[model samples]
Target: MSLDVVVEHSVSLGRLWSEDGLDIMIAPTSVVVADALITWNVNLQWVCDLDYVPDQERPLDLVAFAAPCLWRRRMIAALVAAGREHRVALSSHSVTALQAAIENGLGIGLLPPESVRTGSMRVLKTSAGVPEPLTVQYGLYAHDRRTPVVDAAIDVLLKDIPATPGP
Candidate 1:
């Protein structure tokens, strides 16, 4: 048996299903769930820098995903609801770039747990008056009718879920 994996932003992953080009996708529920079947989800932790303070005299600066990324939109909405303001100092579609920017102290960012560096950043908590970031509900999705290849792929991915980072 052979397996093919495609790494893409969530917006592009949503399009793969309609073209019949994808057998399975592991993505956030907000991105691709409407037509999927046999879905399983895990709650991932959303993390940010420990030293970054919110609601300072000035708007918080952010290093974030680009306009097409759902994380950016979600983070902005959550901050707004909490009566906090922010500016996007840097934006990119690449997770690696976001990590680098956050590490260099360009601005705070909402990052997947795995992308966070232990010494450089920490998970955001309520102490700073920052609203909790959106829940990271990522789902494993498959089409209604599964082929053997698709089934095997799902089995492998299910077995390979990464351990969440520790605080």
Candidate 2:
């Protein structure tokens, strides 16, 4: 009986948090009982320091969207095809999760450049090419996509674009 709580894409939530300084809770995975007001993601990339593990081989894999990924898989696949080992073992539960994985030596994960709050993560420099960034979109979602609450929430969510560290 309440429409005050709206479900929105993580991108929108990230942007909203950046702009309004509010905290955010990630959307639930493995459930699609409702539709979204929007269905897009915000694009981003993962960069790693070349010297972190000079002799270590990078694994070309993808982290979960729940991980720090905004949209990192596309580039990761290409890297794999090119014989570069880089990517994560699994999608992370959150950006925090992705950062933890990196800190724990799991692998680099994708995230907005600006979102990198500490020296714990750094932008990567490919030996012979520019970094490949991914595009993600944000959506205002609801259990019933046709509801006015969903519509208004979508508008509110789309009002601002999020920021990143940069490619």
Candidate 3:
């Protein structure tokens, strides 16, 4: 029996193929309910620091993870699609670091709504336009030479993971 774990920005089961092996792949979806554009807080002082008036278009300094991360890629694509101009003020690999930057009032960043700590941050809906929400899908791959043990494990995993919602 062989087991392999892969962590990647994209899911590509075809690349994991091996000769004389059948691969069973499972991809779960909608792990994130919503992807929100967030800031430290929405208040008079914070608004004044931004030097912007309400209901107006303005370029914003943005915080994002380093390139090659899917979240960053999606955020950039959303910004371009919305026709909103932005500059990256900070970039880090750590989500905790990114959140700290946002808390320091560095710039706005994208995060799953559930990940946000209540009272420390606020969700912002752009008047210009909002980005499409993000969702996560997990993929599991296994070889076809199924031992009884492997089959049982696979069954448990399939039963444990939540099913994706249908359209």
Candidate 4:
């Protein structure tokens, strides 16, 4: 029998075994860490801006993706652990949407380091209580019955994706 498979993000792997048809899974050895970049509007907070003040403290309006996403979950956990107070100014499922909100001066956002644009926004070294960092894991699931095709596919994937670097 030909096995069907689909690959996507944010899938609930815990429920895979309960399903009838799935036979196998291949996954990352460990979670990948994404450092949050605390970005802000250059125009509003720039050193030369009329409203800017040296060493000023202001309440942070935090922007984040909707719940159930690993990034958002980790961000919240870090904030709670650090005893930081924040208001959720915006919640979105898209990283682009979150970026847009930040660019528009809605609030500071917790985003993947790669997504931050240095040209339009400045990454703050420190915020009121910026969390350490966040990570998310990826996994592949397959049934107990493995075919040659499945084995080959797994082999290819392993070869293509580099192993996670050590701390």
Global Cα lDDT for candidate 3: 0.53
Between 1 and 3, whose lDDT is larger?
A: 1
User: In order, what is each prediction's RMSD in angstroms?
Assistant: 4.7, 9.1, 9.1, 8.9
Q: After superposition, how far is residue 130 of candidate 3 from its true place, in Å?
A: 3.9
**lDDT tens string, model 2, 45-131?**
564433344234434444445523335445566566666655457674466666666655555656766665456656654653424
Model 4 C-alpha lDDT per residue in residues 75-139, reported as the tens digit of each score: 66666776666667789878788777777767776655567756555555444346554544444
Model 1: lowest-lDDT 10 consecutive positions: 36-45
Candidate 3 lDDT, tens digit per residue, 1-167?
57665443332323333332234444322222222111121111111113223233666677787876656776777778877777788998777887777766777777765445445666665543445555544445455466787777667776654443322
Candidate 3, poorest ten consecutive residues by summed lDDT: 39-48
TM-score of 2: 0.51
Per-residue lDDT over 1-167 for candidate 1, one digit per residue giving the tens place of the 0 to 100 score? 77788987788887886576788887776776454333443433345565655556778788888887777788888889888878899999888898888777677788766677989777767666567655665666687788887888777776776533211
Indicate whether candidate 1 or candidate 3 has the larger TM-score. 1
Flag the better candidate by TM-score, 1 or 4.
1
Which ranges in model 1 have alpha carbons more than 4 Å from their true place? 33-55, 162-167
Q: What is the C-alpha lDDT of each candidate?
A: 0.71, 0.48, 0.53, 0.51
